[model samples]
Target: MAKIAGLAVGMSLALGAVATPAGAQTIADLQAQINALLAQLAALQGGSTTTTTACSFTRSLTMGASGADVTCLQQYLQGTGHFTFSGGATGYFGSITKSAVAAWQAANGVSPAVGYFGPVSQARYSAIAGTTGGTTTGGTTTGGITTPGVEGTITVTKNPSPASGVKLYEGDSMKTVLGIKLEAKTSDIKVERIRLDLDETGDTASQDSAFYNKAVQKIYIMDGSTVLASSDLNSSTVVEESNEISITLAGMSFIVPKNTIKVLTVAMDAKSSWDSTYNADSWTVGLATDGVRGVDGAGVNQYGPSAAGVFTNSFTTEDDILDSATLAISLNSSTPNTQQVICELGTDNDECDNLEVAKFDFKAEKDNITVTDFVLDIVRAGDTVATATTAYIYDGSTLVGSASVAGTTLALMTATFSDIDWVVPSNTTRTLSVRFDIDDAALAADTFVASTDADDTTAENSVGNTVTATG
Candidate 1:
């Protein structure tokens, strides 16, 4: 059809140009105008609209313009609750209509409206022009559609601070107080209540709110550090409906302000399907619920369609701290005491004789645990030293390792009976020092086979890693 129309215009111009040999130059001028008009018509046609819906305009409609397009714009704004036209549909783009258009543009992500209907407004209008209760839908007595008035937007977020969610590993999860958040903005609707339904599904080993063996999941509503209220899925108010183990949280109040937002917190977790294996396909937890709020002027509440939010756990399974893990050992940097041996001189042998003892330092493998005590085996020694005589652990300048000392076998290495109160955090290494007069004069190399932590749910034996002494 467009090609036919262009061909018709060209033929008409060609005939006119040939007839007027005297004004032959006028042919170029007419062609230019025709081409410009065709380009504009093409733009309007391409705005994702194919209907004869007379909701778009070619020129900008300002305060003085008057046409059917202006009337359509006025009606559209009124439908979106941005305009309140008093009299019958007048085709004039007057002050009242201009003000309404500016407000509509501002609300629809087009800020700082100039009160002029231009291309930007045209694009947005064409998008929502086909709503079920669009301009075509008629209402009794009120003279308009009531169902598709204004929409309320509600959203739940995982990391409200960063706006980007926290990295969750296999065992990693987020909760109301920790990361998950919720926010809602009411448009023309009078929001009397907000209902939130959270569910976990898929064969991904993810557990639902019911997995806790309790009624539902929990959430905390906070205003900064102060907790306003706490709600859960099992609440008598939130309707429980989703089949895949779900929880619901609904807030009821006298009145929720228009264009205002309210935010809260929720719970989200990585799928249980995740193990040591790196899972690039992490499961998603969904926040699903209808825009169940009060209708603007209607006496009843709970209207409109539902809105859903989903958060993808992008963290890989490799990041998971395994149920059982490895604890390793290393040699820390320390100064060597170079005193030569004078073993036979002293009678009060409170410590090793004049033999020069090398002060050796040791460390544990990286973990997210505070290791209070460990059983070490000096599998290999640089000088084949009998055992570690004096062991001390330090957190900066403060000594924190538990005390342990035994003179019996190679299995036990501490003298003076002391254990370092040490901790091995996740993905990070921690250091403790074992400085003693070995039965042998050589630096003692050692192996850590395992460790013990009563509080750690994720515990594994030590890697029994061998730390070879250089000296």
Candidate 2:
């Protein structure tokens, strides 16, 4: 009975060690179950169980390097509180981007953190990425991958000229001549600098620096009612050799949001002191090809005229725009009356200094007129043309000019006055009286009449426009 009980005990011990119909789990099986439960828990919490892959840079990056990789790097730096430019992550690696990379390297304890991104920085970045839990999809960092196509583009078009056919006066200020339209695609764009081309297209067109300076005293760029930038025409900003005008808005920024168009007006202050010879000159202002420089939201440098191509790169105004002021002249109603004069018989000539011969009024319409010279025609009867020796012009009893008569016969004669400076104020009329010195030889009865030819008068305004007279 003792042997049988010992056998039953041994059999019970062996059965306890063997597999049962319930199929109990081993240590490995229990561990796998726990992992599966943890994965499920991670999913519920909006996380991945596997480690995510971060952006990897194969080659070194420095300033001027641009592409998807650079954008990715910039985005990464921005996420890590390194890149902090206003426009966010642009694909181009500029000075600002370089500084950002240097900052990231210093934070990660990388040696010689000089703004340059090399293999050492990439290895460190990769190590950190491996420990992160997000997965990459495209190029942007949703989880670990960066969003694709982050770098935006721009389309440039020439806006219509506001003063296309309108005449621009020399003294006109803030006259809009050309317009440029920039359309941002996909993301916002910040324009940094712009270039313009000036083209003159008339008989009196000139490429002289002085001419350009006088023609365009001040240049202004405007967006609606706001002024974006401005510059006075100078050798530094306006280059005569290239016919290029560069306007850099260093501290100022012009931003065009995604899918929006910004129209920039190019206005100028037409100086009132250009050479009068350029009165018939016409000028056209336009945008230069590949002249617009700016950064997109992805920090990529964008140059234009991108979409419009070279055909629409510039906008031209109509030719034959006059740069002059208007002045009108008319004869005064109180003109000197025609009369006969008696001469002494004993003298070889009779000198009548204050004999008023003619009177005329000069009216300056738009600008102040400076009458420099005049020619008066004298008609006489019963006396030789030599009877009138000299003629004088008086402005309210003040002598303004004097001229000598020339001729031999009594038919007709002309007295010319040159090199005189007489200013006629704008919007005001000045009545001038003319008197003649008549030499009455032989004591003969003589009659004299004086008249001024409107075309023979010479005058100019402040803007160099020759004044045409009419009565």
Candidate 3:
């Protein structure tokens, strides 16, 4: 009876253990139930979410980005016109991602097919995304946008406000300041001032005036046109007036860059006035007019052709008269000759033997003589004797002296007279009488031979007598 009771108790214990929740299920059965509950939870959440096979995407959106992040980037690229997804946001960064990056680079003035979001391109892209202000402290665009990254559209404000600045970005509308229209390939730039100066002299005044006239013609003196001023001495009425002209010149106004500062020293015609003493045939003013003394402190000076300074005396006459006689002598040549003779014969033969003469029988036979700072020559033929002789110069009845003519006397010597002074005395007459005395009786008896030394050969034997006189 006790052994039966023990068996029943053991069975009851086992049954009791089966009824207990914690002690009833096996290890495998418990594991299966827990997994079933996890499946149900995933279904409630709309998928089996055991971290979703690590949530991967086929391609990467950034250098290190991959998995689901790349899928989000593909959607963003399509929304931004960077790519046309053939498979509608395939969640894969494949050839479509590379094509989009390349197209963005080409449109944004960037180079290369580097499929990475570089810092420069990223910054530009950020500006386009309105994320940060695209402001540069150095005042120039140093980089451009190409690939997409964290940077977004940016807004720029001129720090010094009121002054104009510019802003631009890729794949976005550009906003320009200062009403400037930028060219497609060129940037708008600003320039500063430009200036010129024109000054003319009196000698060049007329020419400058003509140039000024031509320059001003058809051109308006607008704000950008040229300015002109007169620097003419004639512009001044007096010594003090020059300052007024200068002041007027200084005050002259003209356009900015377009207009040039021209100073016209217009020349006036030569006029005779108190200023006549200052006016010269080759009149010039300023430093160029040397040796000119200013009449006043304002640079007004006396300028004229320099005097024909230090000229030697040069006198000549076509006709000279003596008492009732007239001697028409041509003393115009630079070198002139004077007649000289010596008389040494008895007073009885003085009329023919001891007399020397240059006879002009008719008025048409006047003497043309040239006198210079030298010796003299007789113009008439046979009027001069080359023999070694003594001659006496006489004016009417006055006896001058007996001058000797050696054999070397220049009858026709080619030697020119270099130093001889001869002047006709005021009392000279038309007939100049001279006497030649031949001391040797043999030579005195010899008939007078015509001298062929005379330059005018036509008058060789024209006069036979020795005491030839001209009227």
Q: What is the TM-score of each candidate against the true structure?
A: 0.35, 0.39, 0.17
Query: Per-residue alpha-carbon lDDT of model 3 for 50-158, expressed as tens digits?
Result: 1111122333255445456566555555544555655755655564465455445444434433334455545444444331112121123212221122112111111
User: Between prediction 1 and prediction 2, which has the larger TM-score?
Assistant: 2
Q: Quick one: ranking by lDDT, best first?
A: 2, 1, 3
Worst lDDT run of 10 residues, candidate 2, spans 140-149
Total clashing residue pairs per candidate? 18, 16, 40
Q: Which candidate, 1 or 3, has the higher lDDT?
A: 1
The C-alpha local distance difference test score for the whole of candidate 2 amounts to 0.63
Residue 275 CA error for candidate 2 (Å)? 1.7
lDDT of each: 0.42, 0.63, 0.29
Candidate 1: deviation at residue 277, Å? Answer: 21
Evaluated at residue 64, the lDDT of candidate 2 is 85
Instruction: Name the lDDT of candidate 3.
Output: 0.29
Scored by TM-score, the top model is 2
